[model samples]
Target: MRLTGLLGIEHPIIQGPFGGGLSSVALASAVSNAGGLGSFGAHVLHPTAITGLVRDLRAATTRPFAVNLWVPHAGEGDPIDPTPHIARLAPLYRRLGVEPPALPVAPDFTEQVDALLAAAPPVISFVMGVPPRWVLDSAHDKGITVIGTATTVDEAIALERAGVDAVVASGSDAGGHRGAFLRPVEQSLVGTFSLVPQVVDAVGSPVVAAGGIADRRGVRAALALGADGVQIGTGFLATRESNAGDVHKAMLHSDAAKVTVLTRLFSGRTARGIHNGLVRELAAHEDEVPPYPVQSGLMQPLRRAAAERGLADYVSLWAGQAAPLTASRSAKDYFKELVGT
Candidate 1:
């Protein structure tokens, strides 16, 4: 089936689900109303909140939309003691006028999934890893189209074998977190041009190309490379409907986009963002940083403070390498521009 038939949308464009509350009902509904699949990144939300978010999205638009969640792992390794990292950031927290963190409780993935299943969004996408067999079965039973993110051909094959409806072949150039599950993220740093067709050739499922795609040219390139559709993140994040902070949005349009860097400073998982003071300061101390959510939790106060102060330094201005290509417009207008509508 063509992408339009697969997702029942007029265009093959999808707004990448931005996690950490950066996604909004307004943005999702805007994209959906404009004839594309909009999505909410529900990774950080609790079960009840997930239900409420779904209800909110449904109320906003009857158009087909998607919800995304991170497939929970016991993390990549054993949880490290977070005290040292918290202490290191204490000075920054004090400057921001917020207390430093104590230990943080990781969100319950099972409860989140159960909540999502109950809400029953039209499509559910997984990143970082694939969901369990029973969860996939449950989603299928509920008539949800399960899409999994892959950074390599092996990961794409794995998802197809797991019976997912589609696989997003996310190249390393993509913004936000690397969804490499089988190999180390550094080893899976394949460019979009190289990755998409390889994934398409290896899997029977439809392939959605993500990473460094911001304009019509990029979209056409992905489709030419055999991608059934395109998933865009930084492009949508720059839109007026997005919840990205003023500082983050400004950075995307500024010269800072020319020097995007991948570092674990923001969330302790490798993420691509514009280079700023915070990232530079913490770059040398990568080993000291705790795992994903722990480091993310520890830095929450700083991020919020940075946002309030309009300081881009501490905020995670997650963007792709092609961030400068993003346009500041409404999600609908941006969608139209991307598809040349």
Candidate 2:
């Protein structure tokens, strides 16, 4: 059976989970009501808040929705030391006339995961890396479907070995952070078209092709390449119901999306987003930016300030190559377009 048959959805479309306040209950429900799976990134929220959000999402619609989490590799070093990275970007903050915030205490991942699994959303998707064996088992025990993302075939194979129900072939062109599990972000760049087929063949499970896909053409292409479904992010960012700021939406209308590059300067892990001043400057001279959540911690102050000031250049305005094809409409409209295909 096709993967969508297992999902029990009318269409093979999924609104990929968005971090940084992009996903909303209204948007997720809208898509689910429209016959596609809608998803949200739950890792960014506090455990209590995420539980409430999941409750709210369930309230919005009985249709299926997905909650995403980032399961990090517990590295040897502590995730502190924002001082050195902060000093590097201090000048950028000075130019913007705002003070960079001192780092907060590191987040409690174990507590968050415990809450997430306890909430038991219908689907639990993971990015950056695969979950530990116990994490996957716990989700399965609750009858929650599991999805894993990878930038290369090896990672996809590993995820399949870990027993994910589905795999997302996250190509380099997909916006947000590169889902590199086996290699450094810089070394793991692979496009969606090439990566999807490889992963499909590498594993017995179905694949959901993500990255750079925006419109019907992308949908047709992914299906043609053996992907059972496609997960789209950047295309929805310009939608009216999206949580992105007005100024950020305007940036998407311009040529900014076409010039995007994968840069780790923003949050350490490489993400493809609208290329602007900070990206251009930081890409030149900088250390590897620590690791996933650590890099995200160091840049939080500047990103917050930039978002507040409506300064596009200083923020990591996450976008994908399909960004150029994004339409400024409600997500419902975009959902209609995808289903009509």
Candidate 3:
């Protein structure tokens, strides 16, 4: 499929938008220059930083790209209360020479939204849920194509009704946060093979498939299964341009890659990643993970220490299920290999 005319791109490949210190200028530009849509996860960045990032990406590659963000959805879950989870990880933090932070982090999403307008990337993809109607309308008015993630046909139809340009069917095999807008993630784990066609059948818009797709064969399979485009994350994590830590890249090639488990320890939201020591422990005690931003906030100190000391367990190293077969290459080379398959 044409992937909605991505500025003369021949392949329907979109670099999966990764956030929480993964999206990088080099990675995005490389994909764009390679005749595929490069996407930057801008939800973690503020307006000025995002604008500068967009400008740098433009300088690096003349081709078009996208900026992605998470829609701020309302929830009844307590925003603050790391007491339950922090109590569990306090011993680990004390050992790391850092004090865990308090809960209920008010992430600066509004500033990020402002930044997206200034950067005005050709496309804006949202995860976590569909944005407010005004946000969608404003984005379209600015000529920004909107893509929203869904895990089921119900979610896909919701996105279509919300005026999204495309619906990304993020199956259960996908890494990172599971965008379950319709039901709890546990009950909505639809694999791409089963979810894509159903979503396409339910919606009039384009359907993008993600989760466990790491190569050209996966891309071809998605197309055969009724996907207009395929979004690959774990495959690109091993690429040279990716900002993932060295430990993360190494893990992609290790046997532990096959043992991925879904845990809510880091973000208090269900996400799958490599099963590390911390993952093993967390899996046994995941019920204590507070709530969204709270758990994410309390884990910052541990994650920062881990990053500084080359420790993998302290961070939420999100990766798809196809991690074991990962191959390292430049972003452009990675895309070539993908489209070639």
Q: How much does each candidate deviate from the true structure in C-alpha RMSD?
A: 1.3, 1.7, 1.9
Best by TM-score: 1
lDDT by residue (tens digit), candidate 1, 1-341:
37668788888888999999899999999999999999999998989899999999999999999999998655443567777787788778887899886656766899999999999999999998878999999999999888899999999999999989889999888889888888888898999999999999999888999999999999999999999999999999999999999999999989988988888888888888899989887778876787788888888888988998999888898999989999788888888888897
Per-residue accuracy of model 2 over 219-307 as CA lDDT, tens digit each: 98999999999999988778887788776788877877778877778776677889898877877654656666666766777777788
Q: Give candidate 1 misplaced runs (Cα > 4 Å).
A: 75-80
Candidate number with greatest lDDT: 1
Residue 78, candidate 1: alpha-carbon lDDT: 54
TM-score of each: 0.97, 0.95, 0.94
| Candidate 2 TM-score versus the reference | 0.95
Model 1: weakest 10-residue lDDT segment is: 72-81
Q: In model 2, how many backbone clashes occur?
A: 1
Model 3 / residue 312 / CA error / Å: 2.7
Error of 3 at 273 (Å): 0.1
